[model samples]
Target: MYFLTSTLNLSVIMFLASLSIPTSGLDCYSCSVCRQPFSKKTTDTMTGCTVCSISQTWVDGKRVTTTRGCDKSCSPADLRIKGNGLVKTCCKTDLCNGNTNLRWFKSVVLFSGLIVFKLTHI
Candidate 1:
């Protein structure tokens, strides 16, 4: 009985947590040739997107082209072949795919805050 009750409580908590996330689609930058590293002031924006993507191609260790737009799929990947390949990043939040390093930092901070909140509340 204790195990069943605990499981039920956990399920209810998970459902409530999911509801805290936004349901509306994200607003993301949409451009055919977005500048490398991205700049919000210089790019077009789109709304109602499931994901934001940045696709960059490189040749001989030099960046060749960069594109940013809204995507239906959400697959984040980085591939290299002899210093020449494509680096594609996809993010679900608004403008989250703009800067790679900055996005990572934001993720870390958000995760840490969530952990702290849970610990303190529990």
Candidate 2:
């Protein structure tokens, strides 16, 4: 009986410890391209999260594209560009300034807890 209790306690502790582990993922609060900002209104079904639009520009007469997001909020300066040209800008405002990281962190914690619970049961 003592051995069984010890094993159960250990399992419970391990499961709880796993709950304390930190997991991280990219979340987009706001995105901008060419000085245009997009809110986190758009969601990626696969990730079930909001993402920024891909910024595209013509460089040396060729189309160049880049992706932004994975953070809470982004600005035009964060995009970082050099040179001069008439660039197209696009943006969303629905989810601007949202706490994307916090949301992601909470989700990760919840998922970890679920996993730990399952493991403890096993």
Candidate 3:
């Protein structure tokens, strides 16, 4: 009986752990099709489209860094503050997240949780 109970308890723990979101492995929507879906009455990128605006630091109409892929670890943000700076702009549209990977927030939450746990345990 004890062995069975122990196994059940461990199984529950493992299942719950799998459900927890990880700090790393943040991904978001991507593909140029998001920019202008069905441009000429034809499908491209095979993904739904939405408009999103990015206001990163730009020079000469060029962005510093760019990457795109489906972010399996993406969580929708209602009003995500870009950064603490002199100027910041936030815009949301259907496809805004297609080319962006906003994963830092997850890391922040994880770190905060760890800090709180250590403080309470100590």
Candidate 4:
């Protein structure tokens, strides 16, 4: 009985995740074409996650830039770049390719804060 109740509680918590849309909604980590070691992140949008890996001829290492807001057409198989030193990847889960340090409770609180911010601004 206790196990069932605890499991149900966790299910409820997960079910109540904010900003989720019906029918394939997802929150992906979003950032633009930022340089390595100094990339920005956003988690308020619904879409697939992407990470573009670049390796410049003059640079000795590779750099990765991530983005969100991709549509249904975006898929892991579709992540590609024609350039010799660029490769992109796509994922279909919330912040799937991003850092996993933030806990679920913190994510919920932060997402709530974002909604409040948007409401106040409008």
Q: Which candidate has the top score in lDDT?
A: 1
- Residue range 14-60, candidate 3, lDDT tens digits: 65454353333323344333333212223122233222222333344
**Residue-wise C-alpha lDDT for candidate 1, range 55-118, written one tens digit per residue:** 8788998778888888878555668689899877766678766664635744644674575576
RMSD of each: 7.1, 13.3, 11.3, 13.2
Determine which window of 10 residues in candidate 4 has minimal summed lDDT: 51-60
Between which residue pairs do clashes occur in model 1?
none
lDDT (C-alpha, whole model) for all candidates: 0.71, 0.41, 0.37, 0.41
* Per-residue accuracy of model 4 over 1-122 as CA lDDT, tens digit each: 98986677566545544223334555554444433453335334445323212112212232334343444443232223443243334433464535422244345445655755654464
User: Cα deviation in Å at residue 94, candidate 4?
Assistant: 1.4
Q: Give, for candidate 3, the lowest lDDT window spanning 10 residues.
A: 84-93
Rate residue 70 of model 4 by lDDT.
47
**Better model by TM-score: candidate 1 vs candidate 3:** 1
Highest TM-score model number: 1
Provide the lDDT at 25 for model 2.
Answer: 30
Residue-level lDDT for 33 in candidate 1: 79
Clashes of each: 0, 5, 7, 0
- Model 2 over residues 1-122: C-alpha lDDT tens digits? 98997788788777666433324432334334322332345633122223332334545554454344443332332222454232322222233234323244345446655866776686
Ordered from best to worst lDDT, the candidate numbers read: 1, 4, 2, 3
Clashing pairs in 4: none
